[model samples]
Target: MRRLGLLRLALGLAFVAGVSAARADGLIVSLSSREVVIASNYQGGSITVFGAALDKDGEVRPPGPYDLVVTVRGPLETIDVREKTRVLGMWINRRGRDFVRAPTFLAVLTNRPVAEIADPATLKREDLGLEAAAERRIAGAGERPTPEDAAFVAALRRLQEGRRLWREDARGVDFIGASLFQGEIALPPNVPFGTFDVEVRLMQQGETLARQTTSFQVVKSNFEARVAGLAEDRRLAYGLVAVGLALLLGWLASVIFRRD
Candidate 1:
């Protein structure tokens, strides 16, 4: 029985070694920080993603033309896209569409124009470009979208861009000496608190050679978390506390500025 156990252990080790050897020819990616805490005064921050390509023998590959794209996607949320039209000299809500499971925040960073790297179909298939990111849809109120819905979708993209919730930078990632590459992503103050996925793609001759992903968390600080919990768990007490604080501040301001 001891001999059989030893043989099984040896086989398992061999299998693991084979798998590691297979993965050694691809790319490896890393992030500087894997978690971020947002305080009450969190303005913004940035993260650096660095990676390198390895050959079959696990050594850095030789210099060559390689394209890199980095994408950061935040939590998903349902959004409503609405259009307004002037009726009788008053603007009113007209047509609207609901998009489910849309990314609350999305940022794309590329070394160069994505068009110069891959074709439209390839980009769409890989969801590499902003247009592909905005094409997400869920079951709507109807069977299919009408021709007029195109305008609404465009409007939604424009609104998101204006709010800085969505961003794309063509010259964001830079390759250093052919083997190593680095990219930076700026997290806005209003970045949603949830799990964010960071994806890195290595491409050559318009074909994706390797892809890797890492995740990070955006969480509220301890004080903010406690306050939010209080608000949700003890609504009346929280409201009273808020009111008391407001009154105390008002009185203090008046006392400081009063004319004798």
Candidate 2:
């Protein structure tokens, strides 16, 4: 994981440098903050991204000239979505699909409906929307998703959306000025703690003009972090301590409530 992160960082920097040397006008983006700390009272919040599209002469163009797509993706993981059936007055797992390399969280924000942003082929080529987010390997090593796999994919999407872990908001991006724009990515209270990659792509017609990638970290608060670390680092000790505390509390409760 560490090596992969370093490799991604190197590639991002190289991509940015190449774009800088080759293009005169493009997209510039900045987030409100680079880190989001999850507190005890964390209900929910939004990550604000401010950006602008530059013209050839280094000028901000009007809204119609370019379209912006903001995609925020959390760490990738495999998930299984199972289908249940009732048989003989009991519920049992019938079958399931394991979606590999799926984003734990996904948010695709656009200024307008994604259909108006580009053609389907173009969208697929650029990996622009919800479909793109789920277009990954299915089951084990098979990268192709069979036609019947659509239902599983839909179920997977439904489950994620229900948990507020995946969403697509057409109106999440707003144009503040000619070329200036801002986008808000919803971060649910139960958001996964990890590094999230934010990609802002500038599209004209059905072609991509420029893209900027950045990342932010979501982490636990100090006390929570310490507790999590203790649990992870000392499983046996932590389990013993937890059981002892529960037993102690139960004993005290019984002693105080006992009647003569």
Candidate 3:
């Protein structure tokens, strides 16, 4: 009995150590200098993306004029694990309300003043099929979602239900970060020039867990700046000169007519 107890204690400690190492930090998301920006404080009691083993060396490169979203799961402490019981099914529903008045918006701005936006689909928890999944496992209702199962649901939502942009913002371009539960996104050069807004939201069952918003500016490239500044070649300068000439010509004509 004493040996068995010691073995159980060792296993328990190992499991806890693994969980702490996994959940030690949250994901911090950023873009490659000129495009995407994350706009909110993510340190509050929310899910973070730092614990997973990803193909970091093999991660896809981001494009210019793009948006990046990062999602994380696990690395749970006893408290976070305990809260998962309360947050799992209800998070989507609660978080969804913040965007109820307006569609959740993510946008990329360009120097050209056009915006590419992705809005999130408005869905309730039931719409997310969580209801059915929950129903199928009455036995598992008392159990927490295994990391694999939770990750699968998050992946499914990313593929099937994202928002479409009806009116793009004045920024450049943007892409939807696949999932709030866990993932990251990158913006690329196809974007124009203005402020790109990065928005991340966690929603379960159509409610929200949290929402974050930030902006990144896209300025003229060195080539673009030089071209824009050439007084002899600038169209705006030429147009202004032409307008002045036209006004002067009209004044001279009027003066000559009046003298006659």
Candidate 4:
């Protein structure tokens, strides 16, 4: 019994050490900024992400068959997509589909095309690519989508892409050195104000070796935030103040540029 106990203790220690070593060979990620502040003159901006793959000794791992996919998920909200048809003298709404909890902004950045990185099952399971990101929300309906539904999804992608709200790039991530990499996430002028989740995945041989999830926030400037808060908290005062500012600006503009 004493000998068996000793063997069991040794095995347990070895198992714990193995697990720790595996974790040590994982990925670490950081962002350039944790907040995206939108001002009145804000056009657009981008955030850079830095990452490193480390080994058991906390040293940079040697370059090998490694892959990284960075997916950004913005705030979720209800979205309604409508189709219009030409009628007698106007365009009329034909039908529409409602997407619940759809991401307001989404981008998938990868070192290379996802299809070349992993098998289809792995990609779908990890929601790594554009197609997977599009179908995932509705995939849990327990029924296969028909051709018409597929069209709606395609249309949705087209619309969001046009608005620059959804993006996918095969060559967005790049490795600077053996185990160091970086990628940039873009924010358009009309980017929604909310929290965004960033998911960083490290893959090897179609298997996810490491994963990390972090978040950042998008918000208006301090003045805008205070103004909005005031409006919400004191509607009457806000309205008066807004009107007063408008009138004052108009008067000053007319006086300054008055026929001179």
Judging by TM-score against the true structure, name the best candidate: 2
Please estimate how well model 1 matches the true structure, expressed as its whole-model Cα lDDT.
Answer: 0.76
Q: Residue 231: error of model 3 in Å?
A: 8.2
lDDT of 2 by residue, 67-86 (tens): 78999999889888888889
TM-score of 4: 0.79
Best by lDDT: 4
Ten-residue stretch with the least lDDT total in model 3: 74-83
TM-score of 2: 0.83
Backbone clash pairs for candidate 1 read none
List residue ranges in candidate 1 displaced over 4 A.
1-25, 138-147, 243-260
Error of 3 at 112 (Å): 32
Q: Kindly list the per-residue Cα lDDT of model 4 for residues 107-151, writing each as its tens digit.
A: 999999989989877776777776666666653343466676677
Task: Quote the positional error of residue 96 for candidate 1 in Å.
Answer: 1.7
Quote the lDDT for 242 in model 1.
98
- Ten contiguous residues with the weakest lDDT in model 4: 15-24
Candidate RMSDs in order: 10.6, 8.2, 22.0, 11.5
**What TM-score, to 2 decimals, does candidate 1 have?**
0.79
lDDT of residue 85 for candidate 4: 84
Residues 1-260, model 3: lDDT tens digits: 64653444344335434533222112223232323222232211211121111123533333233232222111111111111224555633221101111111222222222111222233222221222222222223224555644544343333212422112223222232321122222223233345544444423233433344434464455655555555557878767877999999999999989865
